[model samples]
Target: MSGILETQQLTHIFPNGKAAIQEINLSIKGGEFVIIAGPNGSGKTVLIRHFNGLFLPTKGKVLLEGEPITKDLTEARKKIGLIFQNSDSQIVGQTVADDVAFGPENLNLSRKEVDHRVKESLEAVGLSDLANQQPHTLSGGQKKKLTVAGVLAMNPQIIVFDEPFTGLDYPGVLQVLKQIVGLHKNGHTIILVTHELEKTLAHAGRLIIMEKGRIVRDGEPSQLINEVELYGIRRPYGQNRSVETMTWLS
Candidate 1:
């Protein structure tokens, strides 16, 4: 089968003449869990943003399936859900349930269908009971989960997370991690862009690393993550790795 997402000689250069990513050729298979890691400004975000058509390439093209992403940016955006790094920016509705229903309602889904999706999405994120609460009143972790629920309500085929675990304590990370694993098991393609590795390595099959606007390495997470710090990422020391292993296995 053709890859669900592909970038052909993908290159992006800013107006000021700084290159974000250069010649990035990549293919993402359906249902695969991929980790895109790099030091700050290694082009991880620049590359993935092309997948969903948020940032079109300056020189090359991003393809969804065999077709160029530029062909149908609307459909591509619907298929690829990007959960931004700042969870707060994702929240739009005043109430929790209202927020979760935003995407489905925008799709022109019937009221019953929209309600059903809102219920299911909230339940999936373990926030069903908080449906009637004010979204602004939720804690940081709950807000993140709410952000994910909003995306889940859209029912996208591919989910790309940008710095998903940047903020949050241990339990918060575990909560989000569990949701990500569950989504993958249910057959959603998962692409994660994060600098921290130790807690997430066990959950991913392939690792792609970027440095200086170019791909430095792409391989198994265990092999690539251990050596990624040379570029700028630290693999989360002072925390026991065994716990993360258990998180994935459980």
Candidate 2:
């Protein structure tokens, strides 16, 4: 129960009978900032889907705080928020505030409570003023922030991010990265999946590298990812991209 999550012999096979991930054994402690790095189709997404009971393992069980994933995921998901990479796919409302309120509303919270969560989450993401703005009108970085705010409004104990920086400019990428650090400092357990090793190494406390549906290495970011080829994993971001450690500037 101490660890936020635990998986035993987790395997995920598509309906077409192709195994996306096989025999994954991982444990994540509370308030840990763990990032999963792999190439495209490495099953990072599939693996994360099991974290909050989105996808059950084909041959094993996923434990969230020692509870097995089940049909009624409400109790478990309240503590584990999953933030997709695309805001458009996740957003359900027109305005930023409305989108942030969706999750709390579904939880059956009172109107006033939902309002407070929306306001606080927006402010945390530095988008308090954009509450009235339409999600489609916001920039790529702002949209990502809105998506993050939506997840935060749920008041989750742990958050799973799937490639938070897929299509963003330099500033846009920095914006999400800043929020990640801020959330971690605020005592939120974070598991982020990304392909950009340089950006990830800059913020992640622990790094996990996966290849061919299994974790080849897991340790401090500076230790393993710096010498990726030593573990037989592909280099990311155009070969040997490097960045020093940085927290949010403002």
Candidate 3:
């Protein structure tokens, strides 16, 4: 099967003349749960921003299912969903219902279809009751939930999450984790970027670590747990990483 996403000799330079990422080559398959762990400014965010053509490479190219994503950014985004670290930044609609329906509406789906998706997504995220509430008025955790609901409504095959657990309390984390697992079960490729290994380590099938804007390690979760801390990431606390942790994550 073709990789759902691929980057060929991908290199990116910011306007400041700093190279954000260099020679990134990746083949992310469908329905895989991947975790990207690295320190701040390691180019993890910049790299993923290319998957859906949010940040086109200064050189080389990004491909979605073997087609250049930049050529069809709108269609590429429909297949690859991106959830940023800051939920507040992604929330644009005034009310929760309107926000969740934004993507479907953009797709030009009929009103009945859009409404069905909005209701289903809100219920899935446990935010059905707050459908009419203003997005800016929701609590921090609620905002995060709202953000996920919007992406979920899009029904993308590959979902990229940047620091998914940010601003989430313990219960909130569990809630989000449950939703992530559900997405995985539904066959959506999950590419998660975060430093919090303990919360997500157990569910991830593969782990990739970056340092200084380059991929340093990529392997099964069981094989690389002890090695990530050297690259500014903390190992997950209190886990027997010797055995397969893929099931643990699920």
Candidate 4:
């Protein structure tokens, strides 16, 4: 199967020469939902940034559909959409509808097309009712959904979510997880950067575990999770809860 995205010998370093990513190579297939699992400072965010051209690789290349991603960025970014960890950083316009329309607007799409995409994206995330409200007025969960809607409006082939479940309450986390599953059902290539394993392992087809800036394990989620020591750096959700914990295995 052809990969939708590929990285060859990928590495990143700060100006001070602290390596964040080290000699990584991975191929992400189309229509597959893959999660990058690791503890903080494992370079998960840095890796995703390369996908959208947010951070240039210091040592290797990022290829989109087998070709090197162009430095032009507009074209490269059009193929891969990135939803940031902070919802506030991605939102632009005051109103929800306008904010969601931002990406399509950059594409110079027709007003009708932009409007249609804005409405459809908002509806996909179950935020159609909040379209006219100000982003600042929406709850943290709503803002995250709004940012995701904006990314969806671009209709990119792949979506990279950086720590999406962070800071959300239980209900909010479920909402985001469901939206992610819905996107996968619709056949978008999904790359999720998260420390939370259980939610993603249950949902994603593939799991890549990292340690100290390198991919230490990459395989099916079922197999990877069983190797507890390889993934010990990150803990599963509800580890302290007894009732919901045992139910998952059965």
Predicted structure 4: lDDT? 0.84
The residue-by-residue lDDT of candidate 1 on 110-229, one tens digit each, is 999999999999999999999999998987788889998999998899999999887788778888888888999999999999887766777888888889889888888656645767
Each candidate structure's TM-score, on Cα atoms with residue i matched to residue i, is 0.93, 0.91, 0.94, 0.92
- What is the RMSD of candidate 4? 3.0
Candidate 1 vs candidate 3: the lDDT winner is: 3
Q: lDDT by residue for model 2 over 6-123, one digit each (tens)?
A: 8889999889999999999999999899989877787889999998888888888788778786745897788888989876899888799999999999999999999999999999
With a 3 Å backbone cut-off (N, CA, C), the pairs that clash in candidate 4 are: none
TM-score of 1: 0.93
Model 1 residue 153 distance off true place after TM-score fit, in angstroms: 0.9
Best by lDDT: 3
The window of 10 residues in a row where model 1 has the poorest summed lDDT is 240-249
lDDT for model 1 comes to 0.86
Clashes of each: 0, 0, 2, 0
lDDT of 2 at 30: 90
